[model samples]
Target: MKVNKDLTATASANLILDELYTNTGSSSFNLEHDFFYGGAELEIWTMANQAGILLTEDTDYTLSDIDDTLTNQASRNVYKAVTIDNVTYQSDDIYFSYQACADFVDADDRYMVTREDGQYWDLNSSGGFDLVVSDDITFKDQYLASAIPLSESGTTGLEGF
Candidate 1:
């Protein structure tokens, strides 16, 4: 899929997820229980405008008398910024951030069950499982705004100045 990298970070993530589901039988796949446990990682990357360029093709043309054709098409060099996000990560921060969950109808004490040797066990059993829960999720209506400006240069081309 072709996309303008600088503006489609979130869209890229969604596309990755969609592709996974599609390839693995979308109708039978469960995102949380299947894909997450199946070891799927989401990663994102951002780059400055200096790293790329955008080319704009000109539409203006002149008529040629000899061949009876249009000629002298105009075009402009437009700098482009690219941002890439994928399932594979290039940084450590994104590599370690992941979460998984499961659903059980039993009581909290018996949420998790396991078997060891010849013994059946529950999470709350002696030396069974250690559960930790946190409620530190932050929700924001809008993102923090910055005053960065887009500028073009003769040597380095377009960038945030």
Candidate 2:
């Protein structure tokens, strides 16, 4: 008889390793982070040295949760698709770098709060968002890194990496 076991770890790891190398010539990886930086800002390397060409989003690999701008990213996914040449096999190691809310106590990481209609709040003494509420962001989209592609023009989000 087989006995099922309850998971001691219920949530996904803040920093996880997903091995993409395979003998079947294809692989898929899942990244479930609430504050995932998103695909447009994500940088994925298919090689160990990270010196060769970078894979293009939607063309080489498909990133899930492309619809809404909601805060919940538990449904997000990243799939390294199969190519004509089986691109995944070219390298024995795959690397990726991204920012996410890994920890809540770390001040370097941003915080999330609940919002509802008919609610109001004011910025804290430092002009930062309040834990209870926040005013509508009046800053231009160009000034926001999350809204704009921080990479150089004509580059496919692979500039710094």
Candidate 3:
């Protein structure tokens, strides 16, 4: 999936990484910290007043419900489809950044979608199997040093390690 850099709408730039890496660069030259700050925030809302409507009467619900809510809120415009292994999957949970919802309207295919940072996987599919999202989805976060230790040599650069 591509994270769009266009702040005009909600879709922000999405990048894929085969492995995770830690930033050991200087505080002013840290690429990871800059990368995380570049990420956009997504906001989701209901189209109809039935925003509280639950997909299922039972406590248990399928991913379909989430997919439906998104698509329905988006009205199928911004995020028309989600494909996995060339197979398109539909969901009610559609996501777009905060800016994307500015002019958003709710219609048949209109629904709200939110961007989340972390791993998301589709535990089940119509093919009678679960599809791991690890291979298909990419997550981004604001990179920052977990902790910045103080420097003894008066080198402030080593303090925020």
Off by over 4 Å in 2: 1-27, 32-35, 65-91, 101-161
Task: Answer with 1 or 2, whichever has the higher TM-score.
Answer: 2
Flag clash pairs in model 2.
Answer: none
Q: What is the TM-score of each candidate against the true structure?
A: 0.15, 0.32, 0.16
Better of 2 and 3 by TM-score: 2
Model 1 alpha-carbon drift over 4 Å, by segment: 1-23, 31-98, 102-161
Candidate 1 RMSD computed on C-alpha atoms after optimal superposition onto the true structure? 26.3
Pick by TM-score: 1 or 3, better one: 3
**Model 3 C-alpha lDDT per residue in residues 22-52, reported as the tens digit of each score:** 2212112211111111113222212222243
In candidate 3, position 112 carries an lDDT of: 20
Clashes per candidate, residues 3 or more apart or on different chains: 4, 0, 34
Query: Could you give candidate 2's per-residue lDDT for residues 37-110 as a string of tens digits?
Result: 44544555665444455666656555443323223343443222222134553344545554343221222222
All candidates: CA RMSD (Å): 26.3, 17.9, 19.8
